[model samples]
Target: MADGETIARERIERLESLAREAVAADEEDRARSYVRRARRVAERHRLRLPRSFERSTCDACDTYLRYGYNARSRTQSGHVVVTCDCGAQSRYPYE
Candidate 1:
């Protein structure tokens, strides 16, 4: 039987994929709900979100981010800045 940690991980992965599908389907509210659900699962399991998952979501608004849709990307200096529609900004450094 799968342990709680494994179950939580699976749920997180499922939620991530669902969020992507929701975004692709242009269901912004659904995508946001999925993101929030995944976050809750991770918190309950005492786990950190996957790096890709973390970067693909808005920390402030819990919105799943797509490059052109609800998100804008800009390169400044050595970092890539992603701005969500909610005006939340996150920076990732590029090599």
Candidate 2:
């Protein structure tokens, strides 16, 4: 049997893929809804998202971010900054 964290991670992965597909199909609202659901799953299971997905989600509104669309990215001082449509900003350092 899978542990709580494992199950949550699987759900998050599935949701993220679905969100991406929705975005590719130009269904922005549907993608956002999927992202919101994924965030709730993570919260309920007390699990943190993987690093790759972490940068693709908005912390404030739980919306999935697509660069050059609903999200913007900029690099400064060795860090990549992501700004979401909901006015949430996240920074990650890259080497």
lDDT of all predictions: 0.95, 0.86
- How far residue 81's Cα lies from its native spot in candidate 1, in Å, is 0.5
Cα lDDT of model 2 by residue, 1-95, tens digit? 35877878989999999998898888888988998888889888878877777788888877778899889999999999999988899999989
**Cα deviation in Å at residue 53, candidate 2?**
1.4
> What local lDDT does model 1 show for residue 25?
97
Model 1 residue pairs with clashes: none
Q: For residues 1-95, what per-residue lDDT tens digits would candidate 1 score against the true structure?
A: 34999999999999999999999999989999999999999998899999999999999989899999889999999999999999999999999
Off by over 4 Å in 1: none
- Find the 10 residues in a row with the least total lDDT in model 2: 1-10
Best by TM-score: 1
When summed lDDT is taken over every stretch of 10 residues in candidate 1, the lowest stretch is: 1-10
